[model samples]
Target: MNQPSSEGAAAETQSGALFLMAMLALGTVAPTVFWGLPVIVGQIAQQWGFGAAELGIAVLGEVFGMAAGTLLMATVLARRPLRITLAATIALTAAANFATPFAHSLALFIAVRAVAGIGAGALSGIAMSCLSYTKAAERNIGWLVLLQVLWSMALLGYVLPVVGATAQATGTYVCIGVLALVFLPAIALFKRAEAFVSAEADNSARVDVRGVMLLLGCIFALYFGVGVLWTFLEQIGMRAGLSEARVATTLVYANLASLAACVVMPRLGHGNGLRRWAIINIGACVASAAALTLPQTPDRFAIAAIVFIVAWTGAATLIFATMPRVDTVGRYATLSPGVLSLGFGIGSAAGGELIELLDARAAVGLACVFCCVSLLCYVSLGRAREAEQDALARASQS
Candidate 1:
C-alpha cells in the first residue's frame, strides 16, 4: 500500500490552504451574529436591561440590514473590485462591533448592529459567489461549512464564556471586532469575483426558475425556525432551571453536534437519502422545541439543545447541497442567505412579541410550524428537480 505524504492531504497543500484560509475566515465571521445570538443576546439582556421585545426587534433590524447589504452586493456591486469591496466590508464590520459596547441606547445599538450586519452580509454574498466558482466547489463548501462550526464553537464555547462572565457584554463585540480586522490580511489572497466565474460557458449553468425559488422559500422557512429558537435559546434554558453557565456549556456541546453533521454531510450527498435525513432533522427540531413545552429538566434541556443544533446544521447544509441539483448559475445560492436572514429577522421579531404577549412555549410551537413549512418546501424543490431531470431525459431520447 502507498503511504500518504507528510503534508496530510491535497486540500491541506499551501496554495489551496492559503485561498481556503482566506475564504474560511470570511465564512466563519459571516454568520457569527446569527449563530451566536443565544450567547450575545443573553449577555446583552443581562447587562443592558433590555426587554425581550426590544431585543427581538433589534435582532430583526440587524438581520434585515444584513439582507439589504447582501442584496446590494449581488446586484449593484457585482462588477466592483473584489479586494476593495471585501476590505471595506471587513473594516465596516470591525468598526460596528467595536462601537457596539458604546450603544447605551436601544436606537444606537440597533443602528450599530445594522451597520455590522450589512458589512457581514455583503462579505458573505461575495464569499459564497467565489466558492461556487471554485474548481471543487462541493469540497470547498464542505470545508467552509466545517469552518463555520469550529468558529462558532470558539465563540459560544471559549471566548464568550470567559469574557461574558462579568457584567459587560463588551467582550463579545470586541473579540468579534478584532477577528473582523483579522480578515483584512486575507483580502490580498482573494481573487476578483469575475476571476472565479467558470470559463466553461454552458447552458447547464442556467437556473431552474421555479426550483430555485422553492429553495429560497425553503431556506427562509427553515431559518425562521432557527431565528425563533436560537434567539431565545439561552433564555429558554434559564426558564428550564439551567444556569447561564450550564446553558453556555450546553451550546458548546451543541456545536459539536453541528460539527458531526458537517462531517457526515458530504457522504450523504443529495437525493432521497438526503431528504430522509432532513426529515429526521426536522423531527429532532420539533422534539427539542417540545421539550420546552414540558417540565424543563437539565438532562432534557441538554438533549434538546444538542438536537436543535443538529437540525440547524442540517437545514443549512441542505440548502447548500441542494443548490447544484436545482441551479448552477451561482446567483441563486448567493441570494439564499439574504432570504434566510429576512426570515430569521421576521421570526426573531415575531418570537419576541410572542414571548412578551404569551410565553416562550408559544413562540417555540410557532417555530416548529415554520420548520414543517420548510420541509414542505424542500419536498417541492425535490419534485421540481425530478421534473427537470425528466424533461431533459425526454429531450435527449427524442
Candidate 2:
C-alpha cells in the first residue's frame, strides 16, 4: 500500500482552510446589500409613492429571481471555474444595483431588484459550497452567521437611516451599488484549489436524494414563516403606536440578540442534541408569532421581537451547519439558499394578501402554522437519517 505523504496532506489542509476563510468573508458582505432593503423600505415607499402591496410585490420579484439564479449556478454552472463564475455574478449584481436609482416606476424598480437578487443568490450558493469543504463545518458556519448579523446591524441601524434621511431612497440604492463594486476585488481569492474541492466532493457517498429533498422542504417552510413576519416588521411596530425611531431601535436590539445567538452556537457543537435545540427554537418562534397578535405596547413588542430573532437565528444556524455534514458533497448545501429564497418570495406575497384581507396579527398567526409544519419536517428528517445509519451498519456487519 502506498501511504500519502505528510507534507502533501498539510498543504492540502492549508489550501482548504484559506478557501474557507475567504468564502466566509465573501458570504458576509455580498448578501448584506440585498438584505438591507427591508430596513429602508419605509423610505423607499415614501420616495416612490408606493404602499405595502407594492413593496410585497418587489420583494417577491427579488426572491424569485434569487431562486432561479441559485438553481442555475448549482446545476448548469456547477462545472465552471468558481473564480470566473463568482466574479461575473458579482459584477452583474453591481451593474443591476447601479441602475436601481434610475428606476422611476414600480415595474422598473422590481425588474432591477430581480436582477440584483439573481447575482446575490448565486454568490450565496457558491459561498455555502466553499464552506462545506471545511472539516469543522458547524463552527465555521456559526462564525459566518455572526459576521453576517453584525454587518446587517451596522447597515440597518446606522448607514441606511443616515443615507435615507439625506438622499432618500435613491441614496440608499446608490450606497448598495457602490458596496457591490467594492467586493469585485475579492474574486481573486476563489483560486484553482476550489475546483479541486468540488471535484473531491463528487466522489463522496452517494447522495441521499430523498433525505436531501426533505431537508430542503423543511428549510423552505422555516424561512416562509420568517418572511411572513419580517416583510412587515417595521410596519407592525408602527401599527402598534411606536414612533419610527423607537421601531428602528427595537430592530437594532433584535439584531443584537441574533448576534448573541450566533456567538453561542459554536459552543454547543453538533450532534443528535441539535434536534432538541431546533425543536426548542421552533417553539419559541411560535410563541413570538402568537405574541405579535396581542395588543400593542412597546415593551411587549420589543420582547417578542427579541425572542423571535434569537430563536430564528439559532435555528437557521443549526440547519446550515447540518447540511454539509448530512450531504458531504455540497450539492444540497448549494441549493439550500434557492429553497430559502423561494420560501421568502411565497411567504411575502401571501403575507401581504393576508394583511390586506385580515390584519397584521392574522398574518403572524399563519406564520405560526408554517413553523409547526416545519417542525414535523424536522422530525421526519431525523428518522430518515437514523434509518440510513442502521442500514449502513448492518451492511458493514454482513
Candidate 3:
C-alpha cells in the first residue's frame, strides 16, 4: 500500500489506532447501558424508588440526547480540524459515563443519560473523521464496520454480564472511562498527520444530500427489519419448540458470521466490488426472510432460518463496510453515522409501533420490504460511482 513517508504519516497512524480503540470502548458503553438496563431495571427502580414508567422515560431521554449529539458532531467536524474535536469528545463521553451512577433522582438520571448520548455521538463522529486522515483512508468503510462489529460483540459477549455480576453500574462505567483516557495519546499522533498536509482540503466534499438519503434508507430498512429478530429471537425459538440452548447457539452463530464477513468484505475489492458484494447480501436477506416464516422443523425451518440470519449479517457487514466509501466519503465519514443513526432510531421506533399492529412473522415481511429498498439505494450508488469514473477518465485522456 502507498503511504506518505513524511513524519506525519507515522504519527497519524498511531493516532488512528487510538481513535479506533476509543471508538470501540465508548461505543460499547452506550449499548451496554441499553441492554443491561432491562436486566437490572427492577433493582434500579427499587433502589431509587422510581416506577417502571419513570425508568422507561429515563431510557428515552438517553437515546434522544445521543441522537442530538450525533447531529451536532456531524456539523462540527465538517468545519473544524479533527484532533482537537476528537479528544474533547472522548473526554466528554468518559465524564458522562463516570457521572451516570451518581444520579439519585429519576429526573437527574434522565438528564445525565441525555448528556451521555451527546458525548457518545460526538466521540463516534470524531473517530470516523480521524480514520479519513490515516493510511487506511482508502479502506475506511471496512475498518469502521469492523470496529463496530468488534465493539458490539465485545459488549454483548462480555461487558454487560460483568456489570450485571458486579451488581453495581459504577464498575462498568469506570471500565469505559479508563478506556477514554487511553485515547489521549492517539490525539497527539493525529496532530502530526495534520502538519504534513500536502494538498488543499477538497472543497467539493461536503455532505451530499442524495448520498446521505440513500444511506438513511439503507439504515432504516435494514435495522427496522432486523429488529423483529432482535426483539423476539428467543421467543421465536421457544414458539417453534426449540430448546434454549438452540436459540443461544443460533444467536451466537449469527453474530460471529457477521463479524467474520465484515472483516473479509472490505478486503475483497478496491473499486466497485463492494457493489457486487452488496447484491449478494441482498439475496441472503431475501432467503433469510423466507426462511424466517417457514413452518418450524428441525431439519428444514429452524436450520434454514439460522443460516439465513448468518447470511443477513454478512450482507449487513457489506452494506455498513461500504458506507464510508460513498462519493463524498471523507466528508460523510463524520456525519454519515449520525444520519444513519437517525435512520436506525426512526426505524426502531417505527418498527416497534408496527409490531403492535402486525405479528412478528408479519414484521419479518416489513424487514423484507426495507431490505429491498436498501438494494435500490445500492444500485443507485453504483451508477453514480460509474458516472464519476467515466468523467474522470475522459478528462485524463484529453
Residue 331 displacement in candidate 2 (angstroms)? 1.7
Q: What overall lDDT goes with each candidate model?
A: 0.73, 0.75, 0.59
Candidate 2 residue runs with Cα over 4 Å from true position: 1-21, 46-52, 196-204, 233-252, 291-303
- lDDT ranking of the models: 2, 1, 3
Error of 3 at 245 (Å): 2.4
The regions of model 1 sitting more than 4 angstroms off are: 1-15, 42-53, 98-105, 132-139, 161-174, 192-204, 233-253, 270-276, 283-305
Clashes of each: 0, 0, 1
Q: Provide TM-scores for the models.
A: 0.79, 0.85, 0.79
Q: Could you tell me the C-alpha RMSD of candidate 2 in Å?
A: 4.1
Provide the lDDT at 393 for model 3: 100
> Which 10-residue span in candidate 1 carries the lowest summed lDDT?
1-10
* Residue 15 C-alpha lDDT in model 2: 55
- Clash pairs for candidate 2: none
Could you give me the TM-score of model 3 versus the true structure? 0.79
RMSD to the true structure for each prediction, in A, is 6.0, 4.1, 4.4
